[model samples]
Target chain A: MALPLNYSFRNALVRWRSTIATVLGIALVVFVFVLLQSLAAGIEKSSSNTGDPRNIMVVRKGSTAESASLISRQTLTEIRYFEEIARNENGEPIISADVLVLASLPRRDNSGEANVLLRGVTARGMELRPQVKLAAGRWFEAGKREIVVSAKLAKRFANFGIGQSFKTGSATFTVVGWLDGGGSAFDSECWLDADECRSTFERDMYSSFLIRPTDEAAGEKLITRIEADRRFKLKAEKEVEYYRKQTMTAAPIKWLGGFLAVMMSVGAVFAAMNTMYAAVGARTREIGTLRVLGFRRRAVVAALLLEGGLLALVGGVLGCAIAFYWNGYTTATMGMETFSEIVFEFRVTPKLVLEGLAFAVIVGLIGTLFPAIRAARLPVISALKSI
Target chain B: MSANIVTIRNLSKIYQQGDINVTALDNISLDIASGEFLALMGPSGSGKSTLLHIIAGIDRPTNGECRVQDIDVAKLNESQLADWRNQNVGFVFQTFNLIPVLTAYENVELPLLLTRMNRAERRKQVEIALEIVGLADRAKHLPKQLSGGQEQRVAIARALVTDPALVVADEPTGNLDSHSAQEVLGVLRTLSRDAGKTVIMVTHDPKAAAFGSRQIHLEKGELSK
Candidate 1:
């Protein structure tokens, strides 16, 4: 049946105060949802740089990246001779044995000190990461104390800007360049020359080696070749799956976010139920009049439901608009993967906005069902008698 | 002397409050002919409204049968009764019952929406209803903007919009001032006397009852002629 259009729209507008409250309540819930999801998202983005299919990582058998037992510079050259490794046009192996170290620095927000990763690499680091670009400054020099800070770190902390100097025990290094790796995990660090990093950090056999396999399909065989020779004692992983596993590294945070979303959403559902139930109760006489005027019980129920659904649709749109302001808002988080501060921003993509709206509509549907049933179940005789 | 549009046999209604099952209507049987102006009169708790509700298919009798327009009302399900009401009955209340959000024109157009009438036909029907009530000028005004008499007139317009075979009005002027009550009664009198429409009204006011061609009184759920 074609509903009385003015009846529905007028009732909604007449109760502007309650409508606003419900909308704001929904807005708050959506805001919290976005914040928690964004943090979980940041952690995933920071650790997801290892997803390259043809690339392989070789870490020490006994430790993870945070506490990896180092490999020798001579061993790096020796491993370059392996047949499973790819070579450049000049016959240079597409292999890198980089130095990874952790340093604690004070945060700009006075949230105290946070640990950050410092990766030292060779000239081939640029070729290995074609996606990397200098967003603002040049690349670090070959053997100087000059270093390039990751774009993520640079944007998040004031102390890590170009030409800024930071102490690492007795030595101080100058930030001569700034690098961006298109939002990968590498953008969460500072890059220096391997020899310079060793001198500044004062001791590093080496952290791990990142390898490009000769054939994309030969990754497993290369791991077998390295493991067979007991001299190195290393483990290998395909880069993509490795990054995917790292995303699972923050399971606790994801669990906490999910738990909070579920709990607060329950409260929101109750609010919706109460408000709609009150509306139905107050309109008992009107419903009776409708019944007497020949409108079916289902039509009355549909009108009540449409009221709730309309409220939710308005709230969802406002909530999404509120989330949009958070797009690309940079922040620092202590990443569990590398035990360091990872720079990330809120990623309020179109997909996330749509997911948020879908959630509101579901909540709306659940909230309206009971009230509509109560309204429909009321007898026309009693409804007419009702005050 | 005429075909009975409504027939009731041994109809009864009981209202239970806590421990008391106070009988609102008891063992009533009657017949109402089509195109008749019948007014029902009673004191509080006299069951005049109860009988009206039963005849309108809104309230089922606890014991007995109520057949309106040849169909057993008690036997009809809620949906079917609703369909029957839409097709055959219109109701007017003491409070007018015009949707407060709607203007007089929109209120009158409500029942016509259930029919297959397009907007143009619905508008024409609404205009005729308003003209009959002499509220064509006030059609754009909301219920609150109209007077008690004007509001009731709009309510009457709404009732007649669907061209229902039977019109039920309970306490049609109970809430209005005497002058406004006279205006509403005048319109209802025109409906019954001039247009030959069937109008069943329940009222406590003897003055209003005098407007009907025939009067039926109810005392303690039993009928009195």
Candidate 2:
């Protein structure tokens, strides 16, 4: 098994052009690999599978979000007193009024329009979303003409820092502060006081009401109680469950990334395989010399395979560098749950980089095995005669 | 007196490609001394190289008993044959078949890597082989950087690096100019006389064949001793 380990190493170094081309091919494959993984991560993160779970909303029975519905204050107040309702941390019945709107704004990259979901909240709204943070400046005065933009949205938009003014219709308001939400989807939006947003939009009724169970054991009971009240004729679902439905739309994005990665890798595989095959062919004489000198057939094959794996590793490093430079840089996607715009940063974590390199090495294995085997199997007589 | 280091009896090689069954070697038998310098002289397609190849244990004979140093090469499998060749035989090709990427020193060191010798000892052996071929000063020069004669000398060094007694030279000077050819023949002559190698050379050139202590002519795969 004393194969000349330097056989393929020398060939790869000698044919520098083809070697670099193979490396570049693997780099491209790795790039696709990272891109696909990020797409899946983005979609998965956008739909929080945990928050507001089992908390039902009754919005016009069929309306999807605040912008699509008009539920009267009378109906919300009446539902607050329902006997089957649960209590909050304050020992009060779990109910809060909310108004939602679709506010279209110009994208920073393009002049094209993009929508940011605007959720106007009552006083109890702040307590309900407990994990949310006021990262900078101050919360808006109850009736002030100021709004707190999500940290992600503030970073995404142009000139959107504190005290900056933005316009919609005949009204222009100053950005008062910023908010953070522990990486939830709400970080990609703006929050306003309920009455202010209502007056600005000239709406006479609330869009939706959020509910919490007394002990979460009362969740189904509350749902049945709300649905049975025929006067409002409401349809209810847990808030956590409602967001999960967005996963169906997000599924395509995940698959799209995977499909794109596979497609790109095919070209890379061809490049690497073609290069390795030619490399094997060109070194037949050298292979024979090794065998004649005492190298086992499997040793020769393993040496060539190692060479290919090293080439792919180099490409993987370079491709990962390209992907890493993009981490935390914000980019937008359609919020599948709301059909509005959601922005997130590219997250090129260490784990993803390693997986990219691993994938590249696998591609190397696919590229070099057959060629290496052919080289190892060559008869020493004919191979030596090749030169 | 011939010591009979190699024995061949009724050896044949047939290449079958679907409908074509080509006989490359047919019922060839020969015996030579341990340190004899013999030349195989024949025209193209006379199966001289085929016979040399089979004797070197690089190819199997269809029906025969062939032995080198009393070990039956014909009975050995592919891997065993390879190991036998590595320990007992070294081949110099017409093309000087030095790895293009390796310098003269590296090419010689290549065979030594198969041995148990460490890097320091391997370097010493390679130096001796190169010094013997008169290319010790040019050891750093790659095959492409060396002249035709120098390249063939490097190949000769590679062959001698393992200290194999049986050196196979297949048209070793066929690709060289007259000057390079003369230089190569001079080295082969020195190997037989000074190093006591049993050299089997296949060459069409009368001048190259003249270097061998004796020459055997092959006509249509049959040898005339």
Candidate 3:
């Protein structure tokens, strides 16, 4: 017959000091694990949440990102008149020839300089990306040397607030407004007039083209048409797919989180093992008494394992709660695709909390296995004789 | 006479300590009748505790048979022996050996947990056992809260709660004072005489042995003349 669960629970309560120590040790490890994982989750969310599936991006065939792609003004004219391209109310083609440039700026906290993406788009470009909305002030006029910085970027970079100006390469640009990207990749960029940015940077070619097709079939035809034209040396894909590929920036962080968690788990397991071994040592006579009472060996092992699992479950909950504190808290990291600071928030989903709890329980159960067996295998007569 | 509850024929227990063999029980043979209080007395290393352990099914004899309730305990596997002990034998130890975290009532209810008895039925048995040992009022006390005598009485209640046919005690009164020892011995004597349990106790003190209906002396693994 099985022993009562209260037997295991009460023994743990009696040894509160060791119990708390092992719990906190496991808690610290899990806390670090969950936090790091959430950081990567935030970056992944930022990338995946970007771009509209209806719009298509055209970049140089071998370019990894827009900043590296260069398309001549001649190619923009050739693709603008395609029959599959959508038309605006004014009968103009719904296409945007855009420029992407990197500008170094000082951080608000004076933590040196970091690269920020400055995107230059035509008025039609603003219409194509309806997700980016003006949070404060007014949009910049063409040829006015005015720019609208993202609200997230404005808070982090000096000289980015409305009406402030920052100099770059003999050109001073004024911040006229703040735009909100709703936690998408655009939150890491500032926008200005395409002609003005071209003049300031002395670039005669566009970095990429943003196109809107009349329908899904038209979108597919436009991509096929672009790929067939060897002269253009360009590739076309849905904007959402392009941005999704940029989530590689989160891969290293994911690996590091896993590596560090595995490393810390080893120590946590040893701590749990030490605590359980000491418990067995202290309760040798009690074990004998239980055996004499007819509790089977499996029952003894099961009881000890339950005690360990319960202890770790508490630590898991504590760690998840600690990680939840950072949820939606904005943070920044360098994007590998664009080589610029990308601002995002920690995302702690319910699934991650469950995973953390499961991880802790597995570690606890493994740690208790050998010790429980040792306690069960003890010779009953000799154990009864021990003090 | 009542039927024999325990029968041992030429039982021997040899322990291999390192390379040398030590004989704890040498060709011992004895029979204990139902409802009899038998005490085995001996000095240190006399193997009195070993003999009691073998009879209780906690240890196996090297050779020969130990039959309790008509079942050969030594021939049974470990799992079967555990089940057999739970159903037919209860044990009391020298230190009282009460689980420190459990209350007196819980300690008494332990052996009954292994049985198929329901909670109310187990409670009834535990309560009756405590009343017999005169510790019914102290059922809520933990082992540390009770005096030496009270702890031993609680241990006795635990042994009797299962209502087994055989109760084997190894130095049950060794850690108690004269007053507590007398109280514990009186409870054991009542269990055998009034409740009809066959009790085998191992002790060195003559006073404790005198409380039993029959006494046997062992010296160096051999019964004395």
Candidate 4:
């Protein structure tokens, strides 16, 4: 017969002092696990959630990221005339030949200088990326020394907020507006006029092209056509797919999260084991009483396991609360793809919280296994003899 | 007056303490009839507890037969012995081994958990058991909240809740005062005389033994009747 569950819970409350240390130890581990995983998830979500599937991106054939991609003006002019390219109401091809540059800037938090990505795009660029929206002020005017900074980026870098001017080399650019990228990678960039950026940076080529396709099949056709023409030395991919690839940039953070969780879990396991061992030692007579009352070894083992699992579950919940509190909390890290600060918020997703809880259960199971066995295998006569 | 509920023959229990072979029970042969209250009296280290444990199926006999309800307990494996004990035997401890965290009602409800009865049925049985022990009003109190005599009563209620044929108690009143010990002994007397339950208790007090239907003394692992 299954033992009453409240029996285990009451025992936990009776020995709460020792239970708390084990619970808190597991809690600290879970807290670090969930938070670090949230950080990684936030970074990955920002990258993968970017761009539309109907749009196509054209970049240098061998380049892994847009920062390293360079397509000359002639190549863009040729690609825009393709029948698969979608046109706006004004009979203009819906295309953005964008430029990307890196600028070192001082952080507002005085945490020293960091590299920031400066993106140059035309009016068509805003049309292609519907995820970006102007949060304050107005979009930057074409051919002027005006730029729109992402709200997240504006908070980090000095002089990047609306109405402020920042210098990149000899040129001065004013932040005319703040753009919200809706948790997309665009939140890490500063946007200005494409032609003006090329002139200021003295670049003769564009970094990439963002194009809207007529349809889904048109996107594939465009890619095939671009790849067939080796002279252009460029490749075309669905914008959504291209952006999803950028999630690889968050790999290190994901690894670090797993590594730290595993490391801390070792300590958590030992703490739980110690608590359970003490519980067994303290309840020697009780064990004998249970056995004498005809409870099988398996039932005794299950009761102790249930107690340990319940304790770790409490820790898991506390850790989840700690992580949940940081939801939407903004931060920045250097992107492996762009080599610049990528602004993002911690996303304490439901799936991640569940993962954290599952991790705690595993630690609890390992911690309780031997101790539960010890309690169950205790000699009934000897145990009853214990005072 | 009744058939044998328990039968033992040539039962022996040996313990290897380091280099010495210590005999806890030696060639013991006995029979306990249904509804008999048998008190086993012995000095310290006389193996009274060990023999009680063996009969209760909490410990194994080193050799020979221990039959309860025609099933040889000595032949039972650990799991089967546990099942046998659960189905046929109840136990009361001297320390009143009531779980300190549980209320009196919950403690009484423990052995009933091994039965297939539902919650409502278990509740009814536990209530009746508490009433029999005259602790029905103290059901909600924790073991620590109750006095030593009250705790022993709760333990008795727990033993009876399972409705077992045999109740094995080791020093059931050893920790209580004279008045409380008499109260506990009175409860055991009712179980054997009125309820027809077989009870085997190990104790040192002759006054406690006087309550039993019959008494047997043990000295150095051999029965001296």
Which residues of candidate 1, in runs, are more than 4 Å off? A46-54, A61-78, A155-158, A202-204, A218-233, A249-253
lDDT of 1 by residue, B1-225 (tens): 368888889889988799999898889988888778889998888999989998988988889888888899889888888878888887889888877777899889877777889999999999999999999999899899988989999999898888887889999998899999998898888887777678999999999999988899899988866
For DockQ, candidate 1 versus 3, the one ahead is 3
Candidate lDDT scores, in order, read 0.80, 0.80, 0.90, 0.90
Backbone N/Cα/C clashes per model: 2, 2, 0, 0
Residue lDDT tens for model 2, A18-66: 8899888888878877866766566566556335664666677776654
Q: Is candidate 2 or candidate 3 better by TM-score?
A: 3
Which residue ranges in model 3 land beyond 4 Å of their true spot?
none
Residue-level lDDT for A60 in candidate 4: 97
TM-score to native of every candidate shown:
0.93, 0.83, 0.97, 0.97
Those runs of model 4 whose alpha carbons end farther than 4 Å from true positions after fitting are none
Question: What is the CAPRI rating of model 2's predicted complex?
Answer: acceptable
Comparing 1 and 3 by TM-score, which wins? 3
Query: Could you give the candidate ranking by TM-score, starting with the highest?
Result: 3, 4, 1, 2
Report the C-alpha lDDT of model 4 over A50-142, residue by residue, as the tens digit: 999888999999999998888888998888899999999999999999999988989998989999888989889889998899999999997
Identify the candidate with maximal DockQ: 3
DockQ of each: 0.73, 0.45, 0.80, 0.78
